[model samples]
Target: MFKGNFIQNLPKIYGTYTGGFLAFIILMAIAENAGVSKETIGILFVAFTVCIYAIIGYLSRTVQVDAYYVAGRQVPTVFNGMATAADWMSGASFVAMAGGIYFGGYTYMAFLIGWTGGYVLVSSLLAPYLRKFGCYTVPDFIGTRYGGNLARFCAVVVLALASFTYVTAQINATGTIASRALQIPFELGVWVGLVSILLCSMLGGMRAVTWTQVAQYIVLIIAYLIPVFWISSSGNYGIFPHLMLGDEVAKLGELEATFGLKENSKEAMAAMTFADGSPVKGLKYIVNSHAGVPDGAMAAWKFISLVICMMVGTASLPHILMRYFTTPSVKAARKSVAWSLFFIALLYTSAPMLATVSKLSLMDPSLATGIIGKSIAEVQSIDWYQAWNAQKWMHIQDFDNDGKLALNEFFMRGDIVVLATPEIAGLPYVISGLVAAGGMAAAMSTADGLILAIANALSHDIYFKIIDPKADVRKRLLVARALLVVIGAAGAFVASMKLTSILGAVAWAFDFAMSGLFFPLVLGVWWKRATRQGAIAGMIAGLGSGTIYLYMVKFAENANENIILGIDHLRFGIIGASVCFVVMVVVSLMTPEPDKATQDMIDEVRVPSGKTVLGKQH
Candidate 1:
């Protein structure tokens, strides 16, 4: 009865929590107006939010294996949907997505379309079936379905590599937010963020991560929407920014022409100069073309290829698939996907508005923006410029030996767009702190799910399934907690090295998952003839080909020359996935059919209303 009431009251419970959170924000706004220091507000936002997540984790901590691994498979549909959306909206989505749209223009909409379309594929192809399978991890399904330790081991390898790469991007985003909010070194900020992430997932695992992520989604969506609405309401773009996006884009194009910021234009690519008249080394600022593509000849191919990779990769991601396993029923899993898409759409639809307004804040010719065409010293005197410059995230220089700033002379990292938009638009300091908190929530929420996915794969699939099948619940939970700390620390270390931009790293991770896991997982469910040997061969072939292509494009000299048939680093997954599908089909056809029991298992998974196939056996 208690459980039933709690499940029934979920809407009211989360509704009240949302109201309280908004009230807290109002109180902070009051404090800000009352002469509170910006530093104090920033610190308070981060400290307060992290404490709340930690407390949720402590309350949700469990000794039972089922609770730790699958949240006891009793999560209601709506809350599970919220958790999945928070898990999906990583730092890349919250912090860098708008930046992508700002710089790359409509060409970057591939991410938006591809990611959202991926959910449609999830609901149809993967989510319901996976939930009915009753597995704890992706590897468990591969191992069980294919009837071998080797197939499962391969799945675990892919899950860890892809997840670790993705998690580093999340940690990097956290570091970016923490460094700005707390005024600390990026290296130190990575560790600080890691500690907070650990507190949210280490004890309670998926159980803790689910509830904490729900809270995070609330904070993040509110944080994301407020600034856009604030900017719109201030008479910049009118009351509905989304409706005004077309007009704003037209305005932006005119401004680009006035500033000579066209794609690949000579003026846009001119060398920059420091205030001392020395050349700024290795810098170029290219604005999006009117069509939002760098090269018109290959735009369609690149766009389609990217969309396919993102969609396939979305279906194959192990952490996302794990979310379905926590739903109460297969019906709930399907509903959860619908809800996840709705929640994700809220932020995604607003991103273009934020991107346009942010660009306008700097480039609007009618405004009193003294920075453009102004002397270097004069631009340096701007408060927002000085603040971002001190953080080393923005740079300005004169390339023409002119005493003024050019539109092309200014440069900022794309990762900072969402975080810096509040200040760039002349919003209050409290809004900036709110944006910082939102960015932290986005990064930390995804990090918790990702780190748990990796640790769970290792502890449950590798340590228990393969190494010690007799391991008790307590020991398994202990291993999972310890692995979470180690894997998280490694992610922080890699993040500190700053291998690439947050979006770039995330794309690479998606490609890796697509290359290695997509065909194997998909065919395993849809085709009963898929043998262990075929699955293993396909995983190796696809991942191996994708990795080699990525290495050549990223590390080889004259990397541009290595791009074959216009497939760049981001689109390599198309080739990889195609190769995997063909290889798996051919190999499966050549091998003997699976035994009767295995075929029956596949038949059972197709039916939606049966008891979980492996729920009690293990």
Candidate 2:
């Protein structure tokens, strides 16, 4: 009865929590206006929000295997949608997405389109069916569907590779936010973020992550929206900036022209130098450059290929698919996907507005005009410049030897754009603090889901299912918790190494997932004839081919000259997925079909009205 009431009243409960959080923000704003130090406000914002999530994690802790694995399969639809949205946003979406748009212009909209469109694939093709199949993990589904340790083990490998890569990006995002908010080194910030992430997920697992993500979604969306709203209302763009993106973008392009920031302009292509007289590598800033593709002839192909990878990858990602397993039923799972899309759209639609307005804020002559012609000493003395400069996020060197700064003389890391926007716009320090907390929440929420996905795959699929099928719940839970710590620490270490930009790493993860798992998972559900042998062969072929291509393009000299159909590293998934489909189809045709029982189970998954096929296992 208590559980029933708790679930029934979740909407009201979260509403009250949202209201209280707003009140807290208001109080903090008041403190800031009353002369509270910026550092203190930053610390307070991060500390307060993290403590709240930690407390939720603590309260939601469960020792039961079912709850730990799948939130006892009782999560409400609306809250689950919110949790899924929080999990989906990640550090890449919150921190680096706008920056990607600001730098790459219309080309980066592929990400927004692909990611959002992926959820439609989820709703129609995967989510409800997976819920009906009643799996705790994606690997669990693969293991059960194909009926072999080898197939399951292969799935776990793919899950680990993709989830680990994705988690590192999330940790990188956390490190970026922490370095700015806490004034710590980026390396130390990675561990700091890891600790908060572990606190939220180490105990109750899925249940803890679910509730905490709801809280995070609130913070992240509010944090994301406030500054955009503030900046938009302050400008001629008005309060609803998303509707005015065209005007703002046109204005931004004008500023780029005024500053000679066009991609083809000599000023943009000029060499630059650091403050220490060392030559800075390549053009760091280009107005409206198409990302990854070189020739105009290949732009459409590259764009379409990228969208395909992201869309399929979205469906293939194990951490995301696992969200549907927490829902109460297949019907609820489908509904949850709809709600997830709605929640996600709120942020997705606003990202471009944030990007356009943020760029305008820094460029508009009526607004941050001094930057283009300002003397080095003068610009260095500005508060936002000094703060970001201290962290090495922004740099300026008058490469032309003029005392005043040229547009090309300035360089800023794209990862810091969202985090530094409030400060750049000269908003209250409290808003910066709020954005930091929001960024942390975004990173931590995704990290929690991703780490859980990896750890669960190892503990449940590899350890318990294959090595010790007789293991008790306690032992299984113990193994999972321990793996969580190890995997998270490993991710933090990789993140500290700074392998790639946050968005770059995320794209790689998506491509990797799509390459290896998309065809197998989709085929497993939709094509009953997909034999275990075919699935295994497809996984190896797809992942192996994609990985080799990625290595060549990224590491080998002259590799770009031979790229197949202009498929760069970001679009390797297209080739891999295509190869997997062909290989899987051919192999399955050559192999014997699945036994009748397996075919029936596949049929059972498609129906929406029955109890979960594997529900009794728990």
Give the Cα lDDT of each candidate. Answer: 0.85, 0.86
Candidate 2, which segments miss by more than 4 Å at Cα? 1-4, 262-271, 276-283, 289-296, 368-370, 373-381, 397-406
Give per-residue CA lDDT, model 1, range 1-618, as digits (tens). Answer: 234666687778788888988888888899999999999999988888889999988988998888899998989998998899999999989988888888778788889999999999899988898888999999999999998889999999989988998999999989878887888998999999999999999889999999899999999999999999998777457788888667777887877777887344454445444445555433324367433456675777788888988988898898899999999999999999999999999999999888887787677756665356567788788888887666556778556678777776787777667887787777888898888899999999999999999999999999999999998888888998999999999999999998886777898888989999988888888988898888988988888888889888878999999998778888778877778788888888999989999999999999998788896436
lDDT of 2 by residue, 213-309 (tens): 9999999999999999898887667878877667767666666666775333454335455555555443245456322334685787777888998
Q: What C-alpha lDDT does candidate 2 achieve relative to the native structure?
A: 0.86
User: Which 10 consecutive residues of model 2 have the lowest summed lDDT?
Assistant: 283-292
Clashing pairs in 1: none
Q: What is the lDDT of residue 221 in candidate 1?
A: 95
For candidate 1, what is the TM-score? 0.95
